[model samples]
Target: MYYKGVYHLFYQYNPKGAVWGNIVWGHSVSKDLINWKELQPALYPSKPFDKYGCWSGSATIVPGQGPVILYTGVVDKRSNEVQCIAIPANTSDPFLTKWVKPNRLNPIVTADHNMNGSVFRDPTTAWLGKDRLWRILVGSKHDDTGLAYLYRSKDFVKWTRAKHPIHSAKTTGMWECPDFYPVPLQGKNGLDASMIGDSVKHVLKNSLDMTRYEYYTVGTYIQNKDKYIPDNTSEDGWGGLRYDYGNFYASKSFFDPSKNRRIIWGWANESDTKEDDVKKGWAGIQADVEVTFSFSSLDKAEAFDPNWVNAEDLCAQKGSKVQGGLGPFGLLTLASKKLEEYTPVFFRVFKASNKHVILMCSDAKRLLSNN
Candidate 1:
């Protein structure tokens, strides 16, 4: 989130090693997004509420309060996830270095009797509604169904779960790092999470644990009814619109009031095996890339096969080398001089009955050598 003329980034980090473990909220700040200066770890397993681990969550700048973080805290050995709140010890400090978790309301929201505690986690950035209440969502699942549990609070401290989830879908499995926000219907400008009206459409994004990919839907948020109805423009579950067709998960977006636009980022897990990571001593890297593409026409785009339901499978079949009228066209990154070891990041266009479907592939199939 952008605050006090600086952009703060908090991520899941394992201070001890390259692989994931000993989770804590790693902190970094940047004047420009390109360069960052590391700060002391923001939140760790210091109190009983987060003793086991401190996991993913988001930050919201409250109206009166300077800034608050709502994160998933694993309280015990069973991996029971609960929503917890933390505030900057010194809000006046532009960097907002130290933090304090109030014991009175540390675990502000927990799984109800019918819900599974282990799978409940990742609170989104809270937003205040027109009705004078703060709202947030915690991701979870019931059996084969994914859920975004909604909670409303008059005061930021005390929260109550709604009778039903704001939204859910069967077979999507556990939804991690669920995000809810609003965007303008006509322009690139992003609406604040609290914004409501016909001029804006709300978005709900979920990271599917079963598939290890993130999917999102543009829908109408019926605030009075506390329900979300997705438009029929795309599928609601497995075969839905993805933020990225490649290795991306646990994405969170924040409205940058500075730029009047929303920014999103996600984690890309290591492509290599666990053994390879152990050998390398480092498992992953954080990166950001933006690309622009232009095509003369879509007249010769391949006819999208109806059987191509799974995008990853389709990308594997029609890779970057395969020719197409409009695509299989994009950049090759991390390449060798001979171009034998490069990762192809490209897009392919397929013609459907009424519209054109664009498929993006960041194929890392050749990242490693057999030997």
Candidate 2:
């Protein structure tokens, strides 16, 4: 995916077989800022570090003696408490093609018996800077509420633990995927605009401005650098960051040190309308969007603003918007007929007996475009 000008995307795919057994990284590229083409797998379950499964992880290209990188914590079914780092095997396309080894440093971040499995998983690694060098946000269940762990890395290889989030009643739900960054606020004029992803169509459409936000899709993170305390951060009125309201979850934000700008992206959605991942042979999909953030002050209120750009803007198709019947929606029929095989349109649906269900795809997406 190309952001601003440079292209970037790391692959998250299962390698060994069709099952979620061994996950590895795949690579891709683009130039005109939107179009992208598939490349090969970048990181895979290799020797000491990733033998179990490469699992899910993000990429950080920090200024090192050369290029810097850190990803997730995945353990094979064979061994427990396994933590390792994989070096980029081929620097040509760093996003794809990686070689693994137990960190010469070994477990830059490790799990403790005190910590449980629900948390302590995938690490979204990014370079904040030299002093704030490497910042890793790992899924964690430190307090009763779900949270993430933060670690700082000065050198590309060595990492020091940093502040962990203190939860609060600011929002509901356990924190998992986490992202932190500044957004461009709209000029002091009208309702500050922020692009919000539509859960109904599973694509991001512009929505209201957000001063602070958090979610399960991007997990959760603390916005204020100060007032950050490590232990027992989950307290009432403790204050946390959420990106948007409604069903938008699992959002990840990044700051481009070079541009002095902040940007965010998220899982387009959490679930695929009751379709079984085990059966579709594919699990979750990254929302397929790259958001651009700009700050603004409106109504005399000061706030950080985020503007979202979606696939609808990139690989979006322009045709008569399809309208279907209105009710609940589902995928396959009890008779085992596939929907996508039939038409490229949205549906209006209703639940029926256990087997025979009817889906109408021609009359109701417009609540107000009614004729």
lDDT per model vs. reference? 0.88, 0.42
Per residue, candidate 1 scores C-alpha lDDT tens digits across 304-353 of 88867677778888877778878888888889986768887889888999
Clashes of 2: 35
Q: Choose the strongest candidate by lDDT.
A: 1
Which 10-residue span in candidate 1 carries the lowest summed lDDT?
362-371
Clashing pairs in 1: none
Candidate 2 lDDT, tens digit per residue, 11-92? 5666544444556766666553257777667667655555566555555554443333455545545444333565656555
Off by over 4 Å in 1: 291-317, 349-358, 366-371
Off by over 4 Å in 2: 1-6, 15-21, 76-83, 90-103, 127-133, 163-174, 184-249, 255-263, 269-371
